[model samples]
Target: MQSVVPSPEGLAWAQRLVRLDTVSEHSNLELIETIADHLRTLGVPLRLTRDESGRKANLFATLGAPRPGGVILSGHTDTVPWDGQVWSEDPLSGSVHDGRLWGRGSADMKGFIGLVVARTRAWLEADLPLPLHYAFSYDEEVGCFGVRHLIADLKDAGIAPAACIVGEPTQMLPALAHKGVHRWRCCVKGRAAHSSLAPRAVNAIEAAARLVTVVADMGERWRREGPFQHGFDVPHSTAAVGVIAGGIADNIVPADCRFNYEFRELPGSDAQAMQAEVRAAAAALEPAMQAVDPATGFAFEPICSIPAFSADADEPAVRLARRLAGGGETTLVAFGTEAGLFQRAGISTVVCGPGSIAQAHQADEYVTLEQLARCEAFLDGLRRPAAAC
Candidate 1:
């Protein structure tokens, strides 16, 4: 297919945003303040909801008349880190080459955000029949963390917009459903002793290994079991231990070990129940460790929980997105997004945006010019009568 060139202003906006480094580990204040300044200059009323540390924030801005049935165009300001990845150009350069905008977040999201910000003037001049909002959040790559605070702020302000559109690199397609993500950190404590005196101490690493096996076994059971959703890429709920660390020397029985694990579950599945099952397994192994040392046991910490999201075919948010994108079939994605959180807050939500998820988080991530043009057209459709509630 021939690639359509995107609007120069939109391209410039995308490149400008992509140039900023808003990796999840780092603060997103620069990006947030930049967009805040632009919106403020345009006379848009906006609010900033900061995290507990006051280093990161979510930006919520409004345009047009203040009404109940307004629509929100949402995107995350942060991108995953590109450390240790080999790339042809600097990840933050935001270069335009070969009919695509290339950068760390060009596809994963900044492209959609940039285009939305570029449309602010157009939306303002149109005297929109219904209000339009911009919801740019932080730390989405790590989990849907920042958006939670944004939603809470909205609730406090008593603003109940009818619908939300989360732009998360859907190749310009609307996504109606996605899996949930629940993660945890587990720490095991035991007594350290010489290798020859190992029986006198509980082996923390060995205990953690047992827990890892239990998680793996559960994942395998889900893979072979009957509860399944056919459309998703990974058709069933899955679990795995991603990181683990323990021990100091070969001669010592490790006194402590830590590991991280997660579960990506289907829409109707009980993710908490799965977590409880793992906790039970850990509890079952605790008595043996406690017998060896009073301080030896297991500790678990909740990391992040992104709920599963699904929208009915006839939902207003889904209809609006499909109509603006020239009408395509809705999709189901394996990855998680803030749409679920929005839905939980009583806002009808759907995921749609420029680019493809396949290109996200890669060394040479890029969003095609064609996708940007399509996204711009979709945003322009908001000015039409059919889009009004």
Candidate 2:
């Protein structure tokens, strides 16, 4: 589907947003306050949840009477960083060019947040019975961190929304299923020796490489296995080492090496069991290494884990998205989102928003004006008195 430039109102709001840097590494308070100030004018009740470090926050605001079964308009406030990428202008340009709004977070989803906020003003005067809740979160690029805190606080307050819509970049399709993202860090400790005496020394990098091989083998095995869901492009689970660092000059046998790997598992597979298998592989290598030097072994540390998400195709959230967008088909996205966390909290949820995932995390990232128009229309539909919240 070709994308035309978005409407001026939505484009203006999105441009203002992208100018602010809310990269996961940086604080999202600036962007949160920007929205909060405008929301305050609407006279809605607001609940703000901050992380322990006080660097990020989640803003949950309600526009009508706070009653049971209100609908949630959810989008993350954080964005991935653009450090060394080449761009036609500033990373935060937010310029309208080539029939798209160009900026770092324009597609991954600051644009959707802007559109929802802009449409909210009109709804304030609507006589709809159900409340509309706006949920903006932080650190979503880094393992869905901030929303976890927000969910905990919600649990404490005993507040649960009737349903939720995660504005991930899925081109406004209702995404019903996605894989779990589980990551772990493995560190190898070995003895150091000169290159000439390498035969007597334990090689941490070599040992780490062996485990990398195991991870690749596991990924291949999954590709050939059963329990696959046909809708997903890659129907089976997947595993691979994403990052690794170790080794010194060739003259030295590395004494320490560490690598991080993750597996995106299908609903039927046990992620913990997959991790345990990798740990066992490391354990098998431990005995041989420790024999050379008692201190030479490996250690495993968990980094982060986000569970796979799935929902009934006929659920209210799915049906609402389909109805609002004039489509009932549900898609399975390749990337992860906070929908799983919302589902864990017992609020039915689905991922749907404007823009394509292909534009996310790349230089000159953009969302078409046409996509924003569709999203604004979708958000506007929620204001209908008869639309199921």
Best by TM-score: 1
Give the per-residue lDDT digits (tens) of candidate 2, residues 199-291. Answer: 899999999999999999999988887568988888999998999998889899999999999999986679999998998998998888988
TM-score per candidate: 0.98, 0.97
Top lDDT hit: 1
TM-score of candidate 1 relative to the true fold: 0.98
**lDDT accuracy of residue 21 in candidate 1:** 93
Which 10-residue span in candidate 1 carries the lowest summed lDDT?
1-10
**Residue 367 lDDT in candidate 2:** 92
Off by over 4 Å in 1: 1-3
Residue-wise C-alpha lDDT for candidate 1, range 70-105, written one tens digit per residue: 899999999999889999999999999898999999
- Candidate 2 lDDT (Cα, 0 to 1): 0.88
